[model samples]
Target: MSQPIPNFYAVIPAGGVGSRLWPLSRADAPKFLHDLTGSGHSLLRDTWDRLEPLTGPDRIAVVTGRAHRAAVEEQLPDIADLNVFLESEPRDSAAAIGLAAAILHRREPDVIIGSFAADHVIRGTRVFEFAVRDAVEVAREGYVCTIGIAPSEPAVGFGYIKRGSELIVDGARDASLVERFVEKPDLETAKRYVADRDYLWNAGMFISRADVLLAEIEASNPSLHAGLIALAEAWDDRDLRGPAVDRIWPTLPKIAIDYVVAEPAAERGRLAVVPGHFDWDDVGDFASLAKLNSHGRKNDLAILGENARILSDAASGIVVSHTNRVISLIGVKDIVVVDTPDALLVTTSEHAQRVKGVVDALKLTGRSDVL
Candidate 1:
């Protein structure tokens, strides 16, 4: 029998300090807010638009650090004020999820939450919606459902989900019980995983009832779970959130949901994987931005050179300038050239991943202005 579509809520985690795409992606404006593709809408805006249909504006919640709250608000104005939860401090994904879960549980304990990152590009929206719908139904069945992208290559950048027995439902794509979750693997292991079709990329997208997630937290990390519950209990007392989060967030162990929840659940035979037919990119670094951009250019580029001759026909290169100053580039390839009013980044595509290293070096050298 076809399972009923469950009530859906979206929790977008937008608190990361996107250092890889630095110079362009700053502490004030993270990668999600940047126009990586020159597209007017930012990645976070795109993500919010994609989820609007599945989970209405009211049901959608964005959790971001206090620093990025204004940007998030500016990008997603339709979302109500109360729906945006601001983190007092910069906590990792685990704590971010816990914060959202606590807030949502206070409102609707049975709501099925779809936890996703703010900066991702999904190619097939229709397929994504369908997969999410199916995943929601699975979540309704009391299992934590996570959509797994079929491995396209041996990607060391992502975690892997091992598929077990098939759990087929009418009108839903065939999903498998997750046998185990593997962290970022080395090259050889990654290649082996791709060779074995049983593994899928862990996309960091999750679906589960609020109560179910709380229960899992209680079982897996009792201290964190207790903190979340305490926050939930005092949610109504406006002043409590500030002090409670300040006191608890620093002490909470830094961990990803995959490490804290999905892996353990998979070990206990409680995790499920719904196939994601949509093309997805996490855009973890500038390299990923290049891959997601126009064809031929596998490196992100911002061209601003007068008579700039771009022999390569890839969208990896981006050019941005508010002035009519003609910039030229001759025979330059796989580079990010930004003509900002104050700063500029001229680096090869291969070294784009090392941009964060540059940022760190700058910080160490006390060059806070560039940061």
Candidate 2:
């Protein structure tokens, strides 16, 4: 079946190795390839499942690295081969999203494009679909729309979006003008944000008409926009695209889409946010992952994989088993234990944020094999 909307495309920028969930989320095989929620499908595959309802299976594009190109191809075997945009190396979100927008715009002039992170988790499918439907409506009226998640608690882990006045666009009554974007704040600031009725967690999911998104970029960062235009001209010709991107992709600025596009667009009154009441999480670390799935129990060992034997006596923490091994814990509370064939990680959920530092330490010792 085709999408309900006439012309729409979904762009998933699948970059960044999830270092915090190390030992399981490695460099060669990143977080998106793993099923963090035990949902029976890879995170990347789950992403495809989520968007295929709104924008048919053929209307989606995945922007990933050269190293993981084969993995992405293997995982999403049914997607159009041309829709997988492989970069020579990681040039950050601005280039990735801009390139997708530029190419899609060239083919379908009025297409509404939405950029979603490949590794994010969303519950309440109907709620998510409603938000996307509204977001697409908001984008059609020449606004850069973001799906702002409603805050459930005073969470310091995510950046906040402060919404302003109400928007009166058709089919988007819940849309609000974006007041401004805030960085990840301290605990107290986050508490105040949750207390305030105007704040929502920034999920980094944006929707906009391809031409409008490119126009905003052209006004702010002309060079990057120009490079995207050059790439789009060669996209249809397979032989010409590889050499063109190889020569020009590395020269594009290494910046995030938030700083270069969203924030500025908000300041200029070109940004709109559709409130999403669905449960959402980026799953940056194991501590967060514990909360998302059934692995965050305080009274028992939270086991993620099927091949694990857990015999605990007053021991409570998260356990992820990759190999067929008996993981025994006795009276050691709040400890994080992960057993893999090559490496094992042991830490507490309180210090779960420091797992990325361990990845850095491995880099210092040149442990690329495990990475």
Candidate 3:
């Protein structure tokens, strides 16, 4: 068994409401709280399981919204209460991760922090751990290291990372200097990027020293850095934390860590990329969800939950049922049917990415009951 890294800490940022997987994923119960992969554990739990072995429960922390605090605690009972950082309001990735970095740095000056999202599905556990170890090795050298996934297909939905010459860091032999970070591209651009073999999917996983991360944010955004520092200084003090967060969090700029730190760091030759060969899926939409759970089922049909009475005559798609009602499909192809207690969504796989539009429209119509 691989031993845990003494100073390597992990931070799981579980904030986003997965509107794309609506009906199944709600604001109150986001996608990370659901067992979308039929693993008998929530995605958040899976993430904890993935990192706990490396950091243990003590060194792992979760940064989430106040509403999710109870659920996150329930899922990760071993995580200390002090380790769960709750945000009073949504301040985006930069604030969420920066606060965690600042707090961790205050607690342990030489700590190495790796930020991973809570709702990603990864296979090849051994390979994933090895990549993280390599990233940690690079991180200790004062590099902003990111685990870049090898692109299996020309997926335009994810950002791409351009890798430059390899870094000759010990124990991190496969690490390379990150040349650039590109946003989601058109289909043609994605195809060309994949063909070049010089690009990797920006999986949004970063490893760096706590002080280095905070310093990078300070260099790029001093205001955000100051606010985060103020909050972190009072984070452990119960009486001061609440008041400080109330006064500072909302005022902090709402931006992603990519914009505030990673992208700019890449430009300034401060970023490094370690290729992850493990199979991974963010489960961004129902189509991706269907793909992940499409195993041991008859005729390309994927089923979730206790779908006891699912019958497909000439259909091939996925059905996520939370009810015991009989659901049958006759001649539909690549369809997605999500049946929840309060909401039922029926859309084809082709329109899975557009499900966010449905949630937006509902919000505009003042239908918060379903959302």
Candidate 2 residue 113 Cα shift, in angstroms, is: 0.4
Clashes of each: 18, 0, 0
Each model's TM-score?
0.88, 0.96, 0.97
Instruction: Report how far residue 77 has shifted in candidate 3, in Å.
Output: 1.4
lDDT of 1 by residue, 1-371 (tens): 22334478899999776887777777776778865555568889998988888877787899888888788889999989878887777768877887788778888877888898898878788888888988887888778899999777788889888899998755557777998878899999999998998888889998988888878878899988887777767666788877876776677767778767787778887788898877887877655666566444444455432334444454445554433545555566665565555667777656777888989998999997867
Give a tens-digit lDDT track for model 3, residues 68-95.
9999999998999888999998899999
lDDT per prediction? 0.77, 0.90, 0.92
The better candidate by TM-score, 1 or 3, is: 3
- Greater lDDT among 1 and 2 belongs to 2
lDDT, residue 365, candidate 2: 97
Clashes of 1: 18
lDDT of 1: 0.77
The local lDDT score (0 to 100) that residue 323 gets in candidate 2 is 87
- Top model number, TM-score: 3
> Candidate 2 residues 1-371, lDDT tens each?
43556677999999988999998998798999998888888899999988889988798899999999889988898789879998899999999999999999998899899999999998888888889999999999999999999998898999999999999899986999999999999999999998997999999999999999999889889999999999999988979998998889999999899987899999999999999999899998888877776533556667788667777777777788898887788887777888889999999879999998998999899886787
**How good is model 3 by TM-score?**
0.97
